[model samples]
Target: MLLLLIFGIVLLPKASTLKCYECSSDASGSCKDTEKQCPSNGYQCAALRVTSYAGASKVSDINVKSCAVAEQCVEGSLNFGVSRTVITSKCCTSDLCNTQLAPAPAKSTPNGKKCFRCDGQTCSGTLNCEGSEDRCMTTTVDVAGEKITMKGCASKVMCVGSETAQLPGGIGVGLSCCQGDFCNSAISTRAGLLLRVAPLVTWVMFS
Candidate 1:
């Protein structure tokens, strides 16, 4: 019985192991077909595609597939006038489930919800929210010592999820989401933005 118990314990870990495809590409335009074993902490295999648009012209597309945390499987879009980024991610638990490539995100039609957006140094323009984008979002990130801010419409998955909490930046970035029209118009200074905004995001999630 003791030998059998030890054998079962050893087999249990192997039973939970998953194999996933792992590759990333931007300019190459395709992900290489490479297989990898998922780490013990990884719960799912994911395929992701990111499409970038400048005005009405498509600029670039990125594809990635790998072992992913369950929380990173959310699919969403963010439109910021001059540039728009859309991400589509599919997740599965079975081994090699991410072998299929994620499809390109489709463009969405206007849905009547409006929010403030930025254009260069100006943040007074309005953006029409589309599809599942029912929330207004403001993101401030420090890039190479320069503060960059963007405001736009965002999907609910982008606002309230483990994905947002895991965004790059220990405490230097500020991200806020609100439901009302143009509610993301005003943001605090860089020094206090992250501190003040993180708590406010919880209220937005519940409201």
Candidate 2:
């Protein structure tokens, strides 16, 4: 009887669920204190802050706390001419570990790297890359029947094969990264189609 009880105890599964706070808002608002159990695959608690800027002024900020996958713990920024978006994420493995807010994004100065950027109908202007931004990037997003293209400098982490595989846009978003100065200068229709096709296909299959 004692042996049977010990075997039964060993056979029981260990608890894998994590409890984390969950909230998302476009404005810089407070997160609720309530904690909820995370899904089985969600093994980490994450707190994130995303700030958007137009020119030199901040336009919007988003704050979120929730269960996350390991891939979601990336930190990077994207500059697209008139607008820029920066993301900062903090992650912990323990339950309810994201009780505090993530740290704000650090300010960066120009680092002498330059890349071509799109402005209206022209792509003749150059943008000075800042901080760890050593790569050039081009992004094409097709959301709600509107096609928008953005090209500028990007950090190494935000480039190809890094943690930030896809951006935060909802659907039909495509991103391509490359190196060299003014690498993203040309944005042909065929190139745009190629960049956006795979993501659009994935979205179609999933949705």
Scored by lDDT, the top model is 1
- What TM-score do all the candidates reach, one by one? 0.78, 0.76
Model 1 TM-score, 2 decimals:
0.78
The sequence of per-residue lDDT tens digits that candidate 1 reaches over residues 49-77 is 76766677777677778887776666776
Q: In terms of TM-score, how similar is model 2 to the real structure?
A: 0.76
Which regions in candidate 1 have their CA more than 4 angstroms from the true location? 160-164, 167-173, 186-207
Candidate that scores best on TM-score: 1
Number of clashes recorded per candidate: 0, 0
The residue-level lDDT of candidate 1 at 183 comes to 91
Q: Write the per-residue lDDT of candidate 2 for residues 111-169, one digit (tens) a residue.
A: 88888777546565688987778888887666556666667777777666675654344
lDDT for 112 (candidate 1): 90
Model 2: lDDT of residue 151: 75
